[model samples]
Each structure stands twice: as structure tokens, then as C-alpha cells.
Target: MNQTIQRRLYKLYSSSSRSSFGLRNRISSLGWIVVCGLPLCAFMASMYPRDTFFQLLGVVSAVCIAAFVSVLLRKAQLKVRRLLPRHASVGRPLEYTVEYTNLAKRGLNNFYMLDLAPDPTPSMDVFLHATEPGEEKRNAFDRFFLAYRWNWLKSRFLLMKSKLFLANSVGGEKCGKVRVELLPLRRGVIHLQNMRVVLPDALGLFQRVKRVDQEEDILIVLPKRYRMDSFDFAGQARSQVGGDSSTSTQGQSGEFVSLREYRPGDPPKHIHWPSWGRTGKPILKEYEEMFFPRYGLVLDTAVRAEQEEVFEELVSVAATLTSEMDTDQSLIDVMFIQQGAKVQTVGKNVERVEAMLELLASVEIDPVADWAALKNAVLKHADDLTTCFLVFGDWDDERENFLQSLSSFGISLVVLVVQDEENPVKLNSDYTEITLLNVGEIEQGLASIHL
Candidate 1:
């Protein structure tokens, strides 16, 4: 997230490109057409001094100046309030309503509202490490200058069509609602900084933007979920010892089911004294096994810079699996490594599936991450997990050994290696429950997979 050479280049390109687009949007379609030809007219007039191009250029420039001035003088007093949803998804278009209360004495016309947000530029670390798809095949200048990479990373944060039409007219001291749609380019939270009310001139040559309000709002953009109609966790209860006991009201007494005639060697604590008193013979309280089947969703983070796309695909797959799992029937422990080992559980007695997805949305790739971190995390709860799904960025000896060790722990293994079609990854050995999912064809592979 620092300002490295790569990050600087990215920031430079992002700023220039956004500025160009903002200027283009500020100018109306007619104004842009004239402006585009104005430079050509100037060039022609320079080449042929007595040409009519000079007069045309002068007239267009004068009109643009007057229009710009007209917009600058006209001001709109408006307060903006936004109604945003709690969450959004990457690549999905989401709509929200914005209320504009006009504070001016007269009605305003031909204006729109634009949401302001912090620059969605990638951090220095991200800019330097993550390679844009087909980046190597680009021209020498583009590859060296990182123009392709810059735009690709920046696009991840941009809210498409941030500009929304307010209304043709809004009366003084009145409120108007405008439905605005924005496409999220990336997962994680988008920090909306402020709102702007754009006032255009009669000719619509330029726009005067007024800062209506400064309010920080956030939209949690969930990861892209590759819908899987069927995915089997292949989970089995690890232990029947405490099945539903922990969730019961009288947890210390286990999950009570019924009472039976007391048998030899029955614990006195299990004896139903009231029933015993009524029947003259002792009775014991019976309890059902309480443990829910728990499975591990392991997300491997040891990814290289060139495999950023693979990491993203991996996260999306993990997120999709999390969404598809029936948490009510089983427990899922999402395991990954950050600075250290981390694990989050979601199920009947744990957090919700949404919480797990939200956590996955924030997962980032660590090129130097140690496999031991994930192994340690998984082993910590291995005794309770029935099966483990290892979503790996790449397949190597380390990951293979990790699986073998899990086998020693008697955990069923399902290895899913996420890679690009251009550069496919191979499993080190012939193993059961291993699925190779290409970047673009993950869903097909998922569907065809039996377990």
C-alpha cells in the first residue's frame, strides 16, 4: 500500500484517466463533438492562414467560453441524502435512491447528481505484485510503463455510472428522489466520501459541480459467487459425545431425549430421581448425541504476483462454497492464513454464512505465505472436522504434504487447485477427491465433480 515506483505509475495513470473522463462527462455530447473538431480546425487554420477554419475555430471557442461562464454563474443549493444497501456483490449492478432537497429560492433544471468516492487505486504492494491478464503480450512501452496493469487494478474499485440524472426540475425547498445504479468492480468495502450536484448551462457545454454534503458511507461488496447448485461437503460427525449438548438449555446435563429404566453402572447424575420415586425402581435420563458434522474450508494464500487472478478465482470459489453449504445442518470452519493462522466457524451454533463470506471478501494473497500456517490452523480443529476442502492457488510439495498429514489425522481430503487455462497446474500425485478448476471454467468443473 506504499508509494513504490509501480504504485506511482499506477496512481499517475489513474489520476490522468479519471480526470479525462470527468472532463468528458462534464461536457455535453454536442459540446464534446465541437471540442473534438476544434483542435482539428485550429491545426488546419495554422497550415492555411487564409482558410475559413480559423473563423470556425474562433466561433466554437467563443461559444464554449460563454457556456462555461453561464454554468459557473448558476448555482444550486441542495442537500443530498443517500439510501444504500448494507451489502453488494462484485460485478453486480446495485441501485440506491438519493433524495435531493433544494435549498435555493427557485427551481433548478438540467442537472444531475454524482457520488464522490475515494480513489479506488490499488495499494503499492498490489500494484507491484499483481499482473494484469495478458500483460506480457502488450507492447514494450505499455508493459514497461504498466499502463495496462494500472487501469486493470484501478477498474476494480470504480463505481460504474456514478453520475445519475437528478431531475428536469426541482421546486424550491422541495425534495426529489432519484434512483441511481452503480456497478461494483471489486470485493470489500467502498467508502463513499461525499455527494455532488452538477448544474449544467443552457447549451450544456460544461457543468458546475456543487458540494452538497460530506458524509462517509460504506458498501460491503461481497465476492463474486459462482453459483453451485450442488456441492457435497462429505461430512460425517466426528464425535457423538456432545452432539447438541452445547446448544441445550441445561448444557451440563447433555441433550435430554427421554427416560429409561436404570441399568447397571449408570451414573447417579443420569438417574431421574422423580421417576425413580414414582416407580420404586430407578430410571435414567437418556440423551441423543449432539455433535454436528464439521467440515474445513481451507483457502491457501501462498500465491505469486502473476497468480493474482488465480487468487481471486480461488476466493470466489471459496465464497461460493460457503454460500451453498447448509450451515443449519453442519458446521464449517473457514481456514486461511494472514500474518498468522486464522479460522472462522459458521453453523448452527456459530456465525452466519454471510459472516464467513464477508471474511472471505477481505482475504488477500500472500506470495510468501507458509503452508504451515494453514496446516497448523486446520490441525488445531482437526479432531472435530470430518472433511477438509483445500482451495489452493498452486499445487506443490508443501500442499501435498499438508494433505498427507491431514490424512494422518484421519481427515477426508478434497483438493481443489485453482489456476488459469493458459497455465494449468498439475497434481503431484494420483489422489482421490482432487479437482482441477481453471479460472474461467470453475463452474463446469464444480458441476461435474461428484464430491
Candidate 2:
């Protein structure tokens, strides 16, 4: 095995004492030490007259007993391996099992284990129990190696592994491992760190916790869901300069068209069979390709649209729109209002629009910049923009002017105002105003815009 691989699999050292604190171990240790020391000290004071040698013998006796107990403890080693789910989806519950094996000479009786998880993993229920020798259990709590406890004092051993447990005998002694399964509730990359296993000495006294050195990382990506419906491409097919009508966007009706005579290098689908039959020549059937009107998703990513969740909804809407365009083979463009410089697409590539949406997820809205400047930048691609979806938190006179002038460009417009109810500026309502109370409504409401 590689050095890096070994480091990830078998690490069992702790750096700080404070990192291993648990309530049960502290109380037991304190009680035992106090009980063992107070009586011995009082006896030594009374016996000093008889012989000071006896007093020295008492202190040595305590040291010997502690050392003997420490040496008597069975040597234990813990191993952790992560078994992740093969098929996982974002926002869905996915199981991740952490299997722990204990190779101790005796059972780790009533030990409490806590797994350290990073931010991405959702909260999970965990249990530790020793398995019987040669026994294999799958998703079963009855075979756990250690007992769990709610708190130190109310701790009681039960076979159920609800809050406490006792490790079953392994080989000739108590040993073996337990598996903890976790459900990931969110999408993106997740990293799992080392687990801290806390075990106290006999009689539930003096807890000692050891950190396992294993590390696990997993990635969960959500599949894209693209939409295909209600798009206009009649005028676009007719405008293709060199591409064939069957493969082109020029047409008057939004329907599939038939193929004509095939050129030398024409796509096989474009070869018209019926035309070839009637005229004894090859022809192809061509469907009119649709193109969605380009709309600049100008998010006020400046200081105003600082709420990350709200920004994500805008990006989600943008991504869904781009995916729809890609499915329909339509044309749409995007631009950011507060990104210092203008951003846009040249022709009808929906992939370019998807990239722009990802950019919107990180961009911050600016309040100092002039909205007019951004509007003018959009004018450079004014002929291409079918409409503008201005996602902002507030309404202003300048925004009204921008929308009013857009009608002259022969484009439809929709203004999505995402703001609190206490927004001071009353909207003029010259154009369609969608007050975004919830960000999720943006996509559903966008369908109403006929442009």
C-alpha cells in the first residue's frame, strides 16, 4: 500500500487532551481518586507515631496499585473503514457506513464512541457494539461492541443499543467493530474525518479517548433536468445564412419541416427519401429548429443581493432556462449587471448561458454602479436579446426607464423584483412586475411571459 493510503487508513493518535473530553469519564475518575486518597491520608497521620516507615509504605502501595491496573488493561487497536453508497443523488438520503474493528484482548465494556463528521454530512444516529467471534452482522445494532449512555450518571446497559451497550465476547474476549451509517442531506463534496472513541477503565472510572487516524472523502453530483416545451424558432431557421433548411432555423411556422435534395456532405438525416422516391433523387426531411429569445439575467450581485440563498435561486432559474434552450436547440444570451464589465453571448449557444449562470452564483451585486450603464451595455446585443429578466431587490425610476425603452427594440420584458414587503420604492408597473416573495416562483412565473 502507498504511504498516503496507509496514513488515511490507520491513524490512532491524539494531539490535545481537551479534544477528548466526555462527561462520563470525568465524573468516574474524580470519584475514584477522592475515595481512594482521603482515607489513606487520614490513616497515615494517625499512624505516624508508630512508624514513619509505614506512612511511606502506604504511598508506595497506591502507586503500585495504579501501575498494576494500567498494565492489566488489554491492548486494544481500532480500525475504521468507510463504505459509501454506489448510487447517490443530491438532496436525497444516502447511506455511508463506517465499520470499526477492535482487536483488544478483552471486551471494551460500556464504551461511548462519537464520530467526527464535516459540515456536508447530515446529523446521524450512531452505536458501537462488539460482535461475536466469526459472526457477521449487516445493519444490525444487536451485535455492537460497546454500550452507549445518555449521560454519565443515568448510564445503564441494554442489548438494544439505544443509548448504552456492552460488547459481546470476541474470540475469547470482548472485541470486534461496529458500523455507523449516515444519510447525506445535501449535494456537493463531503469529507469525513477521524472518529474519537472514549473508553473508561474498570468500574466506569477514568475515561481515556483515542482518536482514529482514518479519513474519507466522497463527491455527490446532481443530474441536470432539462425542459423541452413551448419555444419559438420560426424566424431563426430562415435566418441561417449557409446551413440547409432541414438543419437550419429559417421557417415561418413553429413545426417540423421536410428535407429537400441532399448536398454532397449533407447529414444523413437530411436526405429526403420521399423526394428521392417521386423524383428518383435523394431528399431529406428537416424539422424547424426552435430558438429561445436571449434574455440577460442581470442579477444585482452588488452589496444589495448579498443574500446567498436568494442568489442561488436566481442561478437555478438561469440554469433551468439554459437547459431548456439546450434541449430545444434554441438561442438565448445572458449578462450580469454588477460584474464591473459587461458579459454576453455572441450567437445562440445555450451552453454559454449555463456557464453564465454558474458565474451568477458567486457574483455580488453592486449598488454604486449606474444601472443605465449596464442597460447600454445590454443594448450592444439589443438585437439578440428577446427580453431581459432583471432580478433585483428594489425598483427605481431608472429601472422603469430601462424597461420602457426596451419595448422599442421589439423585445418582451419581465422584471423580477425580489425584495422585502417593506421595500420603500413603489413599483411603476409600466412593464410586467413579478414580486418575488419566494425565489422558487421565478421559473414557474417565467412561463407567463409570451416573448
Candidate 3:
């Protein structure tokens, strides 16, 4: 992951390009509009002096000449190289570098530089303005002397540096880490397949644009944080303080469950020779696997807050737990809170949960989701499972009722709730619950839970 990110940044820093036709056309159109229309418009206005037309023409001509000169000076290939951090996490700062040279023959004066960036998605069309060059000193502020000429005969090169941070926009405030990268502009199609721009127009008009072309782009991606605690899962397991389905016996002895006639496919170690001899046939022994009685995962898409991050963490936890239990003959299942489908009786390498993660990552939040209907669906499904791992946040009356219904079904429930700052969950119930702050804790937390 680190190598892949570093290579992309390196490529951007080493790349360069000459001015495009689009830039030339826009600048020319603006200059011509003022140069050709100003004198005519001033002549029509009765309030101005009769000689104003001449003065306007001279002023417009000089401005047009300056515009043409600036365009000639601005034609150059800009090479940008940014340095980004490895092992990227949520709410962490990333660093990058920007480098470019003035490829024109003469010094480009009074011009600002802007790099195009990518859009964050859906209906919000916005691009990152990586760096902005400050305006040069106005020519009017210069001091001139007799017999002295300005040294404007030779072309010059330019070097500028800049930085930008990556963050999440919540309640109109940006939060999270500063991310950076360096990539060299090259010959290939640098597809910022998802690019957009929200910027001021030539006349200071605010315009939002989504770019869909073969060129011009920016590099910025959202982050995922690394955490090491699992309060929800652990709390769920400990909730059963004194029950018949408590912790397994400490001894290594396997508990007996039943016996059956042995077939050719039965393992040799599991064969009960004595019992087989009495019946003149082979018999096999079976043991009930010691495990948490019920483990259920509930995915509440109704909680639209930070939906993407929540989805990632939920999927990571489910996948890790499923993989661990599979190795030890433990059963697991995942239930979607809103979606009717549930991943039940999950075996090794269950594909349903994997599919769920991808779906979750892409799903956008609908601010007006129907929580009542979602709760009803969960209540109906909770009746059939013996042990379930439920993943969710704070509950209302409907969720509380569904949880209470599990008690009658003899189900042992373990809940893994994703943590939030202002909405902390209380350890108020006997049912085991674990709170996961971020995806980083999934592996370590599973290692500590035996059943």
C-alpha cells in the first residue's frame, strides 16, 4: 500500500506540460471583448466627454498588449512532485511538494497559478485548489529614471512551493488528517476519473464544475483511522455474568455431544472401537464446540453520520471475526439492519459479507431513511437465530423491544457498536456488547475473545 501511494506521487512531481488551447482561447476571448467593445460602449454613453472614446481606445489597446505579452510569458510545462506519508489512517496529516519552472523566454508578471483537483462525489461538485500564486507587484508602483531602461529583454524561470491537507467536511467544518503526495506529470493519461471544480469565474461569479476530460486533474483521497480498542465486543461477552452458557470449562477435555455410525469418510481418531465392537460395526464420537451462544451483527444504514467510515469499520470487524471463528469450528452470522437479507450460518470464506462491505462502501446516506421500518425488519429476523452478533448504535423503543424479544428465544447476543464522540453508549445491560472505535481494533480484539 505504501509503495503504491509513493510511486503515484513520484510520477506527478516529475511530469510537465505546455500551455493548452483551452487556456489560450479563454484569455484571448477576454482580452478581445474589452479591447473591441470598450470604445464603442463609451461613445454610446452620453455622460462621458466627446474625447473619452480616444482615451478609452488607448487604454484598452495597452491592456490588450499586456494581456498578449502575459500569455506569451505563461506558456510553460509545470512539473509538480509531492511527498506523502505511508500507512495512512483516518484524521492524520499527509505531506506533499509542488515544483514547476517558468518555461517561457520572458518573466511572466502579475499572473497566478491554479492546479485542478478531484471532486469528493455525488451531487457536491467541489475540487481542491492545491496552491495559489500570489499576485506580482503592480507596474504603476515602479520608479523610473532618465537615461535608464528596464531590463526586460531576457526570459526568466520561476519556482514556487505549496502544501494542502486532507479532511472530512462536517457541519461546514473540515476535520481529519493532512494528506500529501508527489507525482511527475508524464505522457500517459493521468485519469483523475473523478474530478470536479468549485471556483470563482473570470467576473468573480461562483461556478461549480465537474470535469470529464482526458487531461487536467488533482490527487486527493479520503482517510481511514487506526484504532486498538474493542469496547463493544468485550462488553457483550462479559454481560452474561452468571448463566448456564458461561465461559467453557478450563480443562482441555472436549465435551461429548453424541455418537453416530462411522462411515468410510470418518476420521480414524474419532472412531469408538469399543462401541463398534459391541455392535459389530464402526461408530464415531461427536463433541459440541464450546462457543458464545449467540453473536449477531446489525448494520444500521439509518445512522447516516459518517456512513462511509462506519461501513468500512463494520466490514473489517465482520470479516476478521468470521475468519477467526472458522478456524475454531465457531459459528457466526451478520445481519443488515435495514436490508432484509442476512448472512446466516456463515462458514469459512463467506462471500456474502465481502459483498456487503463493497456495497456499504458505495452506498450513499439518505438523510430521511425510515428507521421504524428497519427496526421492524430486525425484530422479525431476531426470532430465528440462537447466537447473533449485532452491530449498531444507541437504541430507541423499537430496538429495545427487539432486543427484549431475544431473551425468550434463548438467544445469546453480542453487540459491537461503532463509537461516536457525543453519543457514547452506556454499559447498562447484561447482554454482552463491544464498542469498536475504528477498524484497527478488529484483529487485536478477536485475538483476545476465545469463544
Off by over 4 Å in 3: 1-117, 120-191, 194-226, 229-295, 304-332, 338-347, 352-356, 364-387, 416-451
Q: How do the candidates rank by TM-score, highest first?
A: 1, 2, 3
Cα lDDT, all candidates: 0.78, 0.47, 0.40
lDDT over C-alpha atoms for residue 279 of model 3: 97
The superposed Cα distance between candidate 1 and the true structure at residue 418, in angstroms, equals 0.8
Error of 3 at 423 (Å): 6.8
Best by lDDT: 1
User: Candidate 1: which stretches are off by over 4 Å?
Assistant: 1-15, 39-62, 121-140, 143-146, 156-161, 235-291
| lDDT (10s digit) by residue, model 2, range 69-180 | 7534624466656676543432344444555566555445455555543421111121112222223432334223111211111121110111222333344233355545
Best by TM-score: 1
Candidate 3 lDDT for residue 441: 53
lDDT of model 1 at position 195:
79
Candidate 2 residue-wise lDDT at 79: 61
Arranged by lDDT, best first: 1, 2, 3
TM-score, one value per model: 0.81, 0.45, 0.37
